[model samples]
Target chain A: MQCPSDKSKSAMLAYVLKQYGIVIALILICTALSFCSPHFLTWPNLITVTRQISLNGILAVGVTFVLLTGGVDLSLGSLVALTGVVAASFAHPGDYPLIIPVMAGILAGMACGAANGVVITRGRVAPFIVTLGMMTIARGLALVISGGKPVSNMSPSMTRLGGDFLGLPIPVLVLCGISAVSWLFLKNVRLGRYIYAVGGNENAARAAGINVNGVKLLAYTICGAMAGLAGVILAARITTGQPNAGLAYELDAIAAAVIGGTSLSGGIGGVGGTLLGALLMGVINNGLDLLNVSSYYQQIVKGIIIVGAVWLDRKHGK
Target chain B: MIIRSSKHFIGMFLLLLSALIYSGCNRDAAPDKKTATDGSRQLVVGVSLMNLSSEFIVLINKAMLESAKDMGIKLIITDAQRSAEKQVQQIETFIGQKVDAIILNPCEVEASSPAVDTAIAAGIPIINVNSATKSTPTAFVGSSDEESGRIAMEYIVKRLSGTGNILIMQGYMGQAAQIKRDQGADEVLAKNAGIKVLARQTAEWDRAKAMSLMENWIQTFGSKVNAVYAHNDEMAMGALIALENAKLKDKIVVVGVDAIADAVQAVKAGRLDATVFQDAAGQGRTAVKLAVKIAKKEPFEKETFIPFQLVTKENVDKFAR
Candidate 1:
């Protein structure tokens, strides 16, 4: 009886650490950086850090749902470039209403997402292979459409979307809004519940009359749509449609999800955790920049932290 | 058995690589043998480019292709795709064919030297173009990257009356242009004690990344940032755009290198304060012209350096194209 009671206490500790380690990491990093750089604690610097990480945060959120369904989408980065190029093509200065380019970009993303969902479900192919193919196709299409050059000279109104409103950057606002909505959808909605079920055990889910394919399809599509929205916002931020934009962004999104305690094996994650993960990444980057760390060392540091966090997560899973 | 291990995949990759090299060598041998039998007066030149994806390289390739045709020279052009290994293989093929001349646009200084040395040992004159190589070449035709940086900094130094807090937006670290330009700009900054560096960071020669970085810098330094100096026009334009959005464009002086078409337009429109000229076409044409001379065993200089020019509103019309 004493041995079993001690085992349960340790198990509870591990569970709490697994669940809340990312939040703790974020707080610790912020506290440490505040001491390293005088600017780290300031409001403007904090907002700047948030805005810098907003792109990664939005993308991390998009990928979180798919991970919950035991799927992956490697095409988010390429889709970002594609959506940005397409939207910027239609977003000349004052020529079209702000809503037109905005809608065009989101619709393009949704259309692409739908295609990804359709193929992954109907073809019965591995989600990894399908999305990997999309990564190449989307990147090639972006380069072809943009002629291997950047589309620049966007209208003021279009660029303004990347600017601030009500003393807050638009990207930060979008990230928060999306996180709120994703939380509600993932926590309260029925389809969201089905996602967890399918991810946990697909065969069991199918036996229980759940549409496992539909849940996966839903996850992949939403992931793609969010990637596209991030893309359009990025184009607005940069004021150009760069064919080479968002290179390796999918990896970052996946890293964010993993860091937030989203198991790659699936069935466990949340947007709230992912958002914290993104902020954790952002704080490290911003703090390093503020501290004037050499860029070469910066890469090494980032790589080590990423691997260590993932390794710890895996240990918890085992 | 279920995993279908990665070892087999690697084995297949090696087999493919060996096959490619063997075929490449055979093709080179076959072409040269035919040329020898025919005894044609056609001077075959091989051009190995660093990569053909960039507009600048495309322009250079076009110039080389057209000029080779005009000179009645048969040309074999290969795109290295930014791979040093691919470039070395191309050089090996050129040596196998005993081509009259080889034009090498190296991917890097150290990685490409051995291959170019092989060409030189084969008695083929290798002309280095645009970029410098570690091994000495028969000749080089390119502009001084430092001069472009110097011109841009000179303008900023004068504009600020030799004193201001400057933010330097650098390019991809470890690249030739990035290193030389920083050296040039920093030399000037060091001379003027009144000048202070607010922050310097590598933006990796990207406009969007530069813009984002600039936005942060603006938030950090704000009014104290009296000038913005970028390593190239793209970054300069990015900084300008960010500054405009932040409503801080009026007091700051912005300068950049690379008088690309967009940068020229920006200069014309008074958005970019100044840009220094880098003559890509001139360098391309000169490289071909000198490669022909070296191949023909005619008189040619070991080093032909092109000059860099400063472009401002004062002379924007002259270099607008």
Candidate 2:
């Protein structure tokens, strides 16, 4: 009995290693890259990486929640663009108080998200198709509202959200805060358990008295709201609301989630892993920049890294 | 379960609270029509921009607005966000408002013809700026795309000694800029047998996308790539970032157009070889001036071609803002 127990312990260890193998590999890659480039380990470079990660980190957090409920939010990126433009309109200097623009921006994002939720839940359409349609529509709306122009002169307080906080960007802080709260929610909240249940087996979750539709709506809403927040932060950072802002951000968010060990099939990941994935991407981009890699080659390397992570995940059955 | 319910309730409450706050805020912040400059009897001018989100367009618009203000012209601005449909609607709105003159930076040359016609039918003299439309306007003010492309190619050929593998990162497919630039690059490539065009792809004017495309090209071509020519500075900047990452910063020469702020800085830092300066602001000022000229029956050139300068490290400081 004791010998069998030891074998089981080793098996559990192997399983855990397999599940987190990509993260370990990512660490190893960072170490190797750091050794190769002296600037890779610097404080400023690290902070830049953190700042870059915040965009995807925030999006991935929302994506993780959706993935937990076996759904996807393709409109998050477009929502960001739309919200950025809308918020920028409100951010006209001396037009209104700071809170007005900020609240309006947040509301715009929520409304967009709510619309997405309604289409997916009430309309009973597939989340993928619904979001894909939304992506175009929202982007079009963004362009329309801004009159094909970039909205500038955003409120100073809004811009402050993108400013530095204790040597780090406010966006990075927000990302960290979001990550911590999401982790806690996933681990300690019953809705979190329901999300996992729904992803693991929707029919089972339904039978267990979980309102799966409500969970999905919540997930998508969160995704939209977070994307909205990201847009606001991005607008603040760039000091302009660009209709073209957050273009192709969805790919980055999805890639980060997958690389961080979120199974595409859903129900197997958390914000912690997504955070790691986002960090990995950010570090790689910063390192590449530091090493003077051409932008074209950087993209190729990013694709490879994403594929490698996925391959490793499959190989380890995680 | 209780904790979950309470959290859900809190979330719902926050959502409702935010919604109420938003409505209230919007109500308080409505733009006052009465405060708007009264131009009821003035020759109203409508400015339809392709997109204002980019620095290039923003600068152009600012210049135009300044010119309009100086001339005491009443101008109404509308943004198309790069949508032909939206641009059409904006033109219709201008027509409805009975503007005396219209300035357009068409999103698509052909797609904007109907809208241009609509304005023309309404007797509004149109001045197309930065980009030309298929329909003739009172005057068109923009740099010659073909010439700029030739200049860019000339710079690259001079730098690479006309013998090397080069990659061409195209802009949006079927756009006037892409067509002209490609034509110019092709003319040069056809003549220089030693210079090989390794790969061509569209960066779509996106820095990140351009960076990724350039990265892939580098990975495929490695040190064999002698130079890169992007349609615009943003894409070039993206390529520069990739080259910097791969430790190939000084190995390959990179050229771009638009000579944007960042691109100019890159050239100053010796990271980029050259960029073509479009003087977008000048074009804006010129467009507004021409619109007012046509509105007032003043003679203006049928077509005005703005001169573009090839900016390099030697001449970059002169162009710096």
Candidate 3:
């Protein structure tokens, strides 16, 4: 017994809630944390939180592409270690120009990604199995290359990339730049639209004469390149290429993507939502630490929030 | 056409079979190759480590290798990758090979104990190095984790004149080092009531984790943090880096366990205040020597405890390289 106009109004409200629920939740959490901990809303603490999440953010953004194309990259954490070591080897003082190390890291990542793409497309293997294999292969390569020790003594100029630029942290700025370009690419580019089409329906995309394999390949390669960039930034931040660095980092990145409403199955998310998801996680961690909460409790709270966020997303989508 | 293709496939298969056999024979000849060069069957000692990826364990492995080379012993080294099950399997493989002696760097006290029993049953002398196994081995060579904890805390207490707010960056929870180090630190804390521990958290003995944890603490505690005691040099170095980033390194006293190369360098550079030296080389050397003696049917001590040393700026030069 509702009027047609009233039904449309409620439908509009539902749409807004579906799209911006995470944003509202993030705001509420931030407000609550600001009240609970005096240190939570300060400028320095905010910068620190952003800096902490930058590595995972870059990774999450990259993986979003693969996820959109109905694929997942389990090799992110290992690739981070491998590329970090490769970049650090060239990052020694007076060894190479800054750009050389950066390029080496990114190229290493891109090659691994391209390899993954080739195997998945041409070799006709599942993304999960291929990436799982790549995970171990990359880790082994990292250990062998670095001889099971942290590669340290990076040049000061390279290390400074981990520091502040103008007033903001360099890593956070990098994340912003990457997020903007990627967001635009996903929205307006023909290849970007094709990524969505392939993920949305593989048979339909093929019927429409789209190159499904090529799009999927590009998604994974982009994912790998992001991982490489993240690795270099991490090495610069820690001032070493630690063989054990980025352990379980992929899990965190995936969680951020999933929490942001990106479907594990494919074709349902964007950078805006992913950044909000990463921001929520960062704020929660910073809030817990500021409140002096025990790490054991912090872990439990984080797990619950991840599950809860995904649950809400599912409920709203349906 | 079908007959010719089948014949070609058969020839390729035969070539692959011969190649595999040749490689197998080469592997079988490795032990004898050493014997042929040595002019005698050299004493073969099998060494299994917890994890080689860790810097500390690698140091122990390096020292053992050096000592084995100097003593003309053939050491068969295997990495368990921190798996107790794998460590036991390696020990069994050594037994199958009829090794003269066995050296074990255990991954856990209880989980790695079966390795010792299996070696004992096979009538091979086994020495536990760097860590303990619940099942008694022939001999043990390790520095006391509790003593290391006590030494690090004592140095911090001295630096602070017995009164200050401190934080402790722990290793992985429930680890032997973590528990004993905590006990040792608590013992010192119980004696000095004026020194208050503001917070203690686990960083898993990882540099990156410790760095993040320290950064958070800086945000929460601000200038109230007076000192930090990390369970390992990696965590210590991490805390130092975080403190340096915040420009608070000068006001804080940072100490850690294990005088790793980086930690020693930090101490010399007047960054890290102090780090306890666990003597990886000494432990490794002694374990290998004792293992050889037991294999040769010579008397050996059942327990060998290497004392830990403290490395500060003054004494860091001695410990460095």
TM-score of chain B of each: 0.87, 0.86, 0.91
Superposed by TM-score, candidate 1 places the C-alpha of residue B240 at a distance from the truth, in angstroms, of: 2.7
List runs of model 2 lying over 4 Å from the truth. A1-62, A70-75, A78-191, A198-243, A251-318, B1-41
Q: lDDT of each prediction vs. the true structure?
A: 0.83, 0.79, 0.89
RMSD (Å) of each candidate, 1 decimal: 5.5, 10.2, 4.0
Enumerate the candidates' DockQ scores in order: 0.41, 0.13, 0.63
**lDDT at B171 for candidate 2?**
89
CA-based DockQ, model 2 = 0.13
> Over the stretch B110-229, how does candidate 3's per-residue lDDT look in tens digits?
999999999999999999999998899999999889999999999999999999999999999889999999999999999999899998888889887788789889988989988999
| Candidate 3 residue-wise lDDT at B110 | 99
Residue range B99-200, candidate 1, lDDT tens digits: 888999888889999878999889999999888999999999888788877788888889999888998989999999899999888787778888888888
Candidate 3 off by > 4 Å = A1-15, B1-40
lDDT minimum window of 10 residues, candidate 2 chain B: B27-36
Docking class of 3: medium
Better of 1 and 2 by lDDT: 1
Instruction: Classify candidate 2 by CAPRI docking class.
Output: incorrect
Q: Residue B101: error of model 3 in Å?
A: 1.1
True contacts recovered per prediction: 0.37, 0.16, 0.59
